[model samples]
Target: MKPVDEYFINQKEPYQSIMLYVRGLILNTLPEAEEKFSYKIPFYNCHNKPMVYLNILKGKDYVDVCFVQGILLEKKFPILRNDNKRKQVRSIQLKNLEDLDHENFIALLHEASHVLSHSKKAWFI
Candidate 1:
């Protein structure tokens, strides 16, 4: 299996289901996204920017749908984890299937893609 596929296959129970659902939401939202393994996680490249990634936090029962340009979108969707320690990245921690806010998350993805596409900064990843 591809290493990225293996990443999903190895997950247990709720995390597996949550990750797969988030993966589907992200891809369905941004069909141009390029899926790859980066930093040992499933990273999606979109609009020539490091758009998003999915991974389970160590010792946590949740999966993170991390947005690379999250700082730009967080004001509109404050549900994202607000870590002052994290400058640009923000994440939505999905602990259960019920936590998936399809409409808002899809809006966030589209907004992130728009911001990244217009960014003049050299792509960092």
Candidate 2:
């Protein structure tokens, strides 16, 4: 994989911190995550399907966490951001890592893993 952005490496305050928090939260909960570079951004996948993708665009105030199967989990946990664009993917944008609700984030991640696992098992039936 190409080197992660020097800016991402050099990022110290909110950006790097946010990424680290999110990275740990994401990896710890998901059982099959493998790091891959997709579209020059950091992404994680399970059984070849994307689970999480993150990007820190230049001069941007937020870090975008994609790969959200928000619609699937919303019935149980309704805290995810809901956009009109589509129902499958939801995003959690953060200005700073502190702003994220860590416990809730992890809960959502666990729910995501469970949903995928169940869906994958059902695929063979």
TM-score of each: 0.91, 0.74
Worst 10 residues of 2 by lDDT: 116-125
lDDT of 2 by residue, 7-123 (tens): 357666777878867877777777577767667777777666666678765766888776456667677766555543754766777888667887888887776777766665312
Candidate 2: clashing residue pairs, number: 0
Question: Candidate 2 — what's its lDDT?
Answer: 0.68
Regions of candidate 1 where Cα sits further than 4 Å from its true position: 122-125
For residue 54, give model 2's deviation from the true position in Å. Answer: 1.1
lDDT of 1 by residue, 2-80 (tens): 9989999999989999988888888888999889998999999886668889978787778888888787778998988
Q: Using alpha carbons, what is the TM-score of model 2?
A: 0.74
lDDT of each: 0.84, 0.68
The residue pairs found clashing in candidate 1 are: none
Global CA lDDT computed for model 1: 0.84
